[model samples]
Target: MPASDSDAPARAPWWTKAVVYQVYPRSFADSDGDGVGDLGGIRSKLDYLADLGVDAVWLSPVYPSPQHDNGYDISDYQEIEPVFGSLAEFDLLLAEAHERGIKIVMDLVVNHTSDEHAWFQESRSSLTNPKRDWYWWRKPQADGSAPNGWGSAFSGPAWTLDDTTGEYYLHLFAKQQPDLNWENPEVRQAVYSMMNWWLDRGVDGFRMDVINFIAKRVELVDGPAAATGGGSPMGPQIHDFLQEMHREVFEGRRGEHLTVGEMPGVSTDDALLFTDPARHEVDMIFQFEHVGLDQGEHKFDVLPRNLPALKQSLSRWQDGLAATGWNSLYLNNHDQPRLVSRFGNDTTYRYESATLWALVLHLHRGTPYIYQGEEIGMTNVRFDFIHDYRDLESLNHYREAVEDFDLDPGTVLAGVQTMGRDNARTPMQWDASPQAGFTTGTPWLAVNPNSADINVAADLSTERSIFRFYQSLIELRHESEVVALGDFALLEPDHEALYAFTRTLGDETLLVVANASDAPLSGPLPADVSGAELVLANYPADPDAAAHPTETTLRPWEARLYRL
Candidate 1:
């Protein structure tokens, strides 16, 4: 079993030294051959993660739901969905993970619940109902329209009218998920109880979804619509409620439990309030500033972003969080397209590009998160039609393009193909078998067409596969104390084609160099220091290349990690 932190010193938190592996359960491996991954399938893969040297596994939501929001809209948190597994299966999976020194962190999506949730069902029954205050509800406008122009994250008005109750309920996402009213003391107590209940059941921690959206703008001001007429101002009162929540529930949580917040629109300055160790509100906040750097006028537009722009944003996050709060470094997740295709040349140098990007992000001064199938260098799915999309966000954007903006359906569908979450939700590729080794039946989402060439079974046999490179990188992070908690400094900020940084802890120093461009770039070492050991290189060890003494020559998309 994993060493119990209960018996360890209080100062050394397990998460601080841990590498987090994110498992989008459905896209991870399908052990039942049903084309959809489940808890048992994840249970079977614990050994793979253990061998890869990951310390924790952050499982996406698996709660009972209508699948309206892909399990984010939960009807029941206390029970596992039949599609995934039974409650007993979850316990067994947890135990199995612990046995391999891998901690499991469940995704806590308390910001909203499925309209099918008992709480929402009761709240929507009647205005005078006992549970009416559980969710945000407002009276209709004089014209019988929405209460305000506030927009949903998925695209339309945030308020959903219920003719039965003569009120409109707020939902930042799909109308199927009504936002819970954190203003209600009863609701706050209920959420706290739920958190305690899960922690008591042996979960290592939680990955809170849209945590900042828990508290809304009490005044309910009408937000200015986006140029696309879909923008919504994220509420102002969010911080206050989060502070209160921390004091009441998270202040004295048992065992060094980790808490990572999905707080979009959080500026670097505001991020400090939630992430500062002294405040203890959250261990880290997933700042989306870097991810959206390349986004176009529309949310789903797959516009190209400049490499310099990406480097600048990444540097800003590193510098801003250097002393305030920690960062949860990641390139892809359930919400993003595959990094290999999005930022790198996934077709030509897929494995090389994936390794280079991983080296650039993982070696930074923060806890790294690896999405499932990413280590094998997964690429995005290609769809010829909009109907192929499983994500609500993509569908909403496509509708806007076709119905409102009058854009060509083909163009809109092509954009969705590039940026849709369905690209990331494809079934995990185990082998070049029937159903891409995902399942015997048709999967909820289709597997990537290129899975045959990049399945785990094939990569495991290849010495130079992206998966093996990731394994080496992860092992290096765990064994080197300096890499885990070193001070980070960006080197050659103006180097247009190079993303280089130095991580140092006292006299122990490690330099990470990446040729961000597609073309070869040769340059002098960041410093005049010597005796640098070619500890780990994405390419062959370049003794002759280093023999030149002063300058370093890096091949196209080359990446290297050196210890001095």
Candidate 2:
């Protein structure tokens, strides 16, 4: 039987209440005019982050890498990327961040390693090499083609033939990033050892990348004859691998540390097992279901987002995991487009929509994540030409769609504009200076053209800036126990543009309503908010409205919270 709300476990660890800020290291800040952000750059901005009231900073991968997939293709697990900083700089950043009561969570990309990594290098040396089993390598089929029909996420076949070994290796992502063979005990041990080394250095936790793909199906069969490409995300051994990782790396050090796995194509049931405290797998998992709502089979093929579908998807996860597990709430990240541009209005109603989105996400019974530029209501970039995009996946897909598939270039460009990951990877807009104050040198990627008006420096002093609104939301989560542990109930789930929900803990209940549209909405209270005390709102609502609450008018993208 499904567990009742009363049977739910105790309030989660500190992380459950904590607001995590994800910093894309390469674009967050640049200190040395190197056109790239580094550890010192992040350290320099510690005061800004602390002022924003986030509990932890989740840094995207900064490990040594060839950077084929940014820093996800790690070449050395134990060392910091030279472009980012050295080991000493990392330690300094950690120490300084902790001094200000901020925890640091490193990105752990263990699903694969760069081909330049020593293990992969040795693995490809010869079939008889000692480290041959460190990565997934298979002999070519009789037709001299790939070992399987699996596809690469970046386009084309997932298998890349290694001339030195005369065999094909699996890479679910880019060809340069060869998937690790977690079936081999030594590979798992190496990953754990690297994690331990970082933990011993005072890093608080890890945000594991594509962790679900660690264990692929043993049979390595073809996905579907009609499939474009990409191997199965979930494998039979995923649970075993995660359990082993917990026992070996996180068993005794579980307390005070966060472990969130980024699992693509993961179902709610699989997420429960992965996050169940008794199972000891992970503290939480980042599921892609919500983000993929408007995305077609291919991410570039955009579709209209349905409000009911989104509410149903999120509500199911909230109810499914209420008894034992936790959720990580977010709308934007390194691999996704900016939330305001994708889901909310980014023009005249930018601030209103951004804050409304924040209210909706943070008020949910889960830990909220704020992407680097999200607090300031950053919009997606408008790069006129494809060359302006630096994302490998975006570039490859654009080429595949236009050149191979013979699709219209204009159509492909429009899709790329709407869904490209590069939209979120533009340089951080610190000020209105040249290059948006990111660096004196030319930025690796173009700074958003609108940064002159929409930037941190300009918003810092604005009374109703999106940044200040996000700060208030974070403060609320920290102050209200009900916000942290309340049982969630979706209100008006069928409403096309109104997203309304309530959180109940003991006798205290909080109602949150947002008009997730560009037009004004007026309606009767979705629930009994008769005696609700006005707690928060993105726009100034008449104080008398709360006294006699028969009906309310929500401004464009307006959001409100009331305590009952």
Candidate 3:
């Protein structure tokens, strides 16, 4: 195992102090003229990421797959997909990333595998195959229906019938990806072997997909439907399998490897259990509470809620996890919409609004993660037809809205238009060239229409661009101990327009303030803080802006960071 100095502070553990940049490989860049992103394309972008000051890059899944879930469904763990590159190219990318002081974390989809996977193919060949138990299969009901009434995450019943076997298999997501039977000891051992194999190849760590879903309700009892879609409750026995996974794959034998779990549908208290360092289940976990703030109950309705309520939830999670375990903090990801269009005024004040939103989340208590093109303030695409959508989740939701709910296609498209996974999957805007230079031929997904005006090459040269603001933000956190590991205290919780917080480590203090409203209000700084020095701001205070205290108003969606 690789070793660092034992005396190094735990706060400065390899991952906590490291800034992570998420690269959705398909959209990031294309180098081989294959019209699809490859490992070589990622290698070409290493210098750009390093210059942006991120210490690590977490690439979305690149393993062999049918692209059922945009590579989230894996057919083989040990080899790179033919379209992405060869295994040798993956090794080259890893080496190049390390040369730039950036660690690479592979996405590990352990909860399931692609139906085309060799293991799943073997399991489904017959009712009495050697690997029959490798996946969850249940006997059909007397009525020949699925054993339970659970709903798939994408939509409709969670079970898919295997006519050949005369049984049903569980699929939380698309039917093409079957849930693995983690209860099988052989399955657990196989997962562990894969982990070791990747680590042996010098991959830094793993961003575990649906880590908490590995466990399940062994009884397979029916659950009450959700209030809206009447979906099934989360699987049972999730924690039991998590503990086993920790012992075998994550902790007992691995040395200082980072593992962040996508433990959706977890409560703050439940999240505490999965991330407790002593439990060894994960280094940290990404909570989706903030991401779903504007979402309606089981839907995306665009109904605005009180900002304080959203702030309160974030505060609770931040304070709750501050000392107990770590946090994988982010505002956008490949599975979510772009933050600029969804959360901020992306059209009118793209730069300030986007940077303000970034400051509010990135400078918090957890380790910050930046998604591809987020630094450049990417906005959501406006598609005209249902055929425009590519994500499986969006397609299912649209179908459900039109056929099951009897809703008009326009309204359903509007809902998905405003909030959908495809927003984040658009080909990255690298330059003003055709298709934003994301591909030489046609892109796998359409590029944003505004790409010509919002590409990275343009932002890199502009001093006041959102990309530069993020670059500055990254530098501030890395250079300041208080921002990285100090105790966090959210101040002025009731202030409607002011989002303020302090990070103090002994005598050093850092203050983060965001003007969340179109107009600004002022209050005295936190009672304990004095003589604050302006560090970074989306809109810097001019002499006149700095002179007035109570009257010092901020422009719409302004944000600032200070040191004391």
> Which candidate has the highest TM-score of all?
2
lDDT of each: 0.81, 0.88, 0.80
Report the C-alpha lDDT of model 3 over 488-527, residue by residue, as the tens digit: 7888787777788877776777788777766655555444
Q: Quick one: how many clashes does candidate 1 have?
A: 3
Q: Could you tell me the C-alpha RMSD of candidate 3 in Å? A: 3.5
Q: Judging by lDDT against the true structure, name the best candidate.
A: 2
How accurate locally is residue 560 in candidate 3, as Cα lDDT from 0 to 100? 72
**Rank order (by TM-score, best first):** 2, 1, 3
lDDT of 1 at 533: 76
CA lDDT for candidate 1: 0.81
Q: Which candidate, 1 or 2, would have the higher TM-score against the true structure?
A: 2
In order of appearance, the predictions have TM-scores of 0.94, 0.96, 0.94
